[model samples]
Target: MQNVSSQQHFILNGFAELGDLRPVLFVPFLLMFIVALLANSLLVYVVVSQRSLHQPMSILIAGMACVDLCLPVFFVPNMLLSFLFDWKGISLIGCLVQMHFIHFFGAFQSTFLVWMALDRYFAICTPLHYQELMALQRFLKFIVPLVVRNMLLISLFVSLAGKLSFCRNVMNHCFCEHMALVELACGSTAINNLVGLLTVFLIPVFDFLFIAASYILIISTMLRSSSTSVKALHTCITHAMVITVSLAVALIALLSYRIKNELPAAVRVFFSTMYLLFPSCFNPIIYGVRTTEIRQHMLTTLTHWKRLADPEALDQDGLSVLRSGKSSAKALHTCFTHIIVMVISLTFVLTAFLSYRMNSLPNAGRLFVSIMYMFLPSCINPIIYGVRTTEIRQSILKVLFTYW
Candidate 1:
């Protein structure tokens, strides 16, 4: 009641000054955003233009790619620019708009992820219904309402946000989030808080629950099949890993926002890394490791590229090269790459932990590392998944050939 009374008049405390480590934060996120845009655009091209990928799984992946493509574009560039220019000043109206889109996009992403879970569940558990139910037209019809509803809800909430006068605008995170913004509001924000709780907490939590339930059913159904337990387990493992990572990020973000005083800039940046960057960066790698079809396709594409690079090399020397202990060489290369990736990931994770534990490292370091870590998945996705996959390669080639 007292807070509400005082909320009628409020002045923002602007932390618009450049942080000490601004340069370290700017380059990687900019690069990552560029790569993510290109990779996801190519992914979209492969999924949509390729008739071979008109199937359910591919369609769902296309949706996911679209979401991934939008994620960095919407948030990262503005953040990089803000940090680089040392202009953390956000207009009240502009802040509201950003908050709206962030919520809409983030919510849409969670919704689509649930759809993916359902897609896999159907593919695994109810193969009979997959074709009929997951048809492109039918899926669009199902998705249209979700898109419309989210837009409406986000708009409504943002309008409410504009009403709340800001007591402070110095955000902990790079971007303006609903919870963070709301905390700055001088108004009681009881209604806005309720809406935030609903949008951020209720909606995603329910979707997560649904996705979890679908996976549980899928696992049960797979277990009963008894045809290939290993295959089922592999699929389950990949799904579980992504869900775990995403949920962990979401939980941490919620905690940081809710417990405002305790959380630092570095902690907020860490959450941003997990929530925004990790999924885009590591998704392709995770899919590549888990899905044999994707791996085989990638290998075929790589081999084709190698052949194309040296057309005449394939005849005598190429045959010899193919025959000359290819398996052992490939096995060695795979082992080395795996070891390197594992070591790098472990090292980076440890560094983050140490930075957090010893409050010595600045927020900029955390942001820079987060950006780099997130950059890999999005940047590598096109080369690792699309160019490497035979189906996508063939489709891309076919399109290029036709255009030429």
Candidate 2:
């Protein structure tokens, strides 16, 4: 074993255990990365380009989309390199950098979610104050502190990890995970562990509690109003779903980390990867499909594209056939398609979560579950949104046929 202190680079032993199966995994992983990248980028573009989307909620969504856009870039490319060419060596400084951004973005994501919850709380619980409270300038001012706080904390964590003398140069899982790197150190990691705990567990716990409290208040407020209750609850559904999925995956990842000895190496790796990847890929889909304003803007953009491609396709009001009206049967068909996609996505996610608890399950089955859990949501989300959302579907078809 080469001493990591003397070694210039650490070897990332990513999926080396899979051997020939690495290539098979590469394509899907690559596809997921691309889809997540495009989805998030498109979301940011839609929010930023449209002047009407400059509200508090849209600003927050755009901020999150930016974070999600950068989050995957830190790890996925390196993972792809490992899978395709078996290139797993990352420089020690590079490893530290990756650890920094990974944690930074992860923390930023939690911050964004908390703020989103607060945004909803204000919007629902106190509508009049929301405008004054969540103004763009004020929101940015609030976010700057949290952003700085995350940077400082993560920097300290990384600095503590970097100062450690490493006995070995190989990290067991993919990318440079903080604890994974800490575990490789030869020196006493008590401080590193403490700081890691503070950054990982304590900070996230605070965030989770804050988000929960916000929603509790939101729900209470909604219950008090019989007239606007249904509409208010509808507004919260997308934010609630994003929060649920993000925290659920984070909880499972934390569990996998805690019980690393009980689960197979691959299972642990997949859980951690899913935690990193899922929220970024899924959040945009939730907001895009569920949020009325953003969806309307996207539809408008697509309608413009349709207009350029074929003026005859749109009716007098510039509404395409798909947007003009949906038949009852068509509505049912779209609803069923959404339900099926939701069921499939949930099944894979649940299987991955359950696989860690079930020691009796075969390693290969767990591995397959993990792969599907990570891969399907990112790819499936865009397809569902693009296909089942009638306006988007028609616009896409118009563009495709025009180009063809």
Candidate 3:
């Protein structure tokens, strides 16, 4: 292989070995990206818009959501292009920038998790001083410094990788991974190796230790007090779930990278990609489902939509008449519409599955099945819902006429 200049583009060998599975993989990746973007955006909006959620923990969660919102954009677009068009060439600068942001967000999240743990520690261990200790202004002061520190450290780390002379131009993974790029360098990478170890491994380990200590103290305090223990433990559950998810993905990625030679190329890539994808996609979902205030807020918002659609159907306590087993025409219409959409969706999905499983199936039939699987449900869903769902039709009309 010839040596590539820094000015040249590095080719990403993204899932090329998967052959026909590439197009099939595109749908889930696209769905995950959309879900991550929308979910994090919604979480941030909820925290910012609702006055009841203006607490320290809520603000930290919103901060994490903001980071999650940006994290997927760094790699998902390239992954989509790779899956669909097989366009995987990225310039050296572009690769470095992507590497920097990926690591930056990862580090930021790890550090922010520690901050959240600290918030919980203060809230539980020092209830009387919690408000004063985690004041908005004071919290911003702490967070701003950490943000700058991450930017500077990650910039230096990427710069060190950038300084190396490349002996190869092909990356065996989807995105621009740090050590993968460093491994392509021609000369000694002793400095890069050391800094990479520090930035990638030790820093996160330290953050994890701090978080563990904070939680230990929190649990000790909770154990000592019987009255507030349940309430305090409830409040910590969401953050605990978030930490577990983030650390689990990080551990998988770390082990995959460490044992890259033992693992298949696909397994390594999948684990690394999951590190970047899973937390952002699931953290807000965990919060939404587990946190009482946010869950109640979401329920309230859905109930408000129902009230807007059929005010008279809801009693004084906001319970819908449909819940009383009195089936209405509208309820029947919704059930039928849902059944039709489910049947159509499942039919296409099953056809797609059979095409992949049947060895005798032709490539043309497989391709057609893939296309139908991808397009049919998406194209029909909105039309079906708008036509059958009164709420959707009214919402569309209100938006159009209000804007007009």
Worst 10 residues of 2 by lDDT: 320-329
Per-residue alpha-carbon lDDT of candidate 1 for residues 1-404, written as tens digits (9 for 90 to 100): 33443233222222222246555667766765776676566556655765766677666666777777777766676677665775556666666666676667677667876777877776778778888778878677767876776787688778887777666646666776777777777747788767766666655677778878987898677656655334555555556656665776777776666554455556565575557765665554454323444344444444566678985666774455344454533543344346435544654676566666566457776666566566755654464345434467556545644564
Let me know the TM-score candidate 2 reaches against the reference structure. 0.78
User: Which 10-residue window of candidate 1 scores lowest in summed lDDT?
Assistant: 9-18
State which candidate has the highest lDDT. 2
- Each candidate structure's TM-score, on Cα atoms with residue i matched to residue i, is 0.71, 0.78, 0.73
* Pairs that clash in candidate 3: none
Q: Order candidates by lDDT, high to low.
A: 2, 3, 1
The TM-score obtained by model 3 is: 0.73
Residue 277, candidate 3: Cα error in Å is 1.0
Cα RMSD for candidates in order:
10.4, 9.4, 13.2
Candidate 2: the clashing residue pairs are none
TM-score of 1: 0.71
Question: What is the Cα root-mean-square deviation between model 2 and the actual structure?
Answer: 9.4
The residue ranges of model 1 lying beyond 4 angstroms of the native Cα positions read: 1-19, 136-145, 288-404
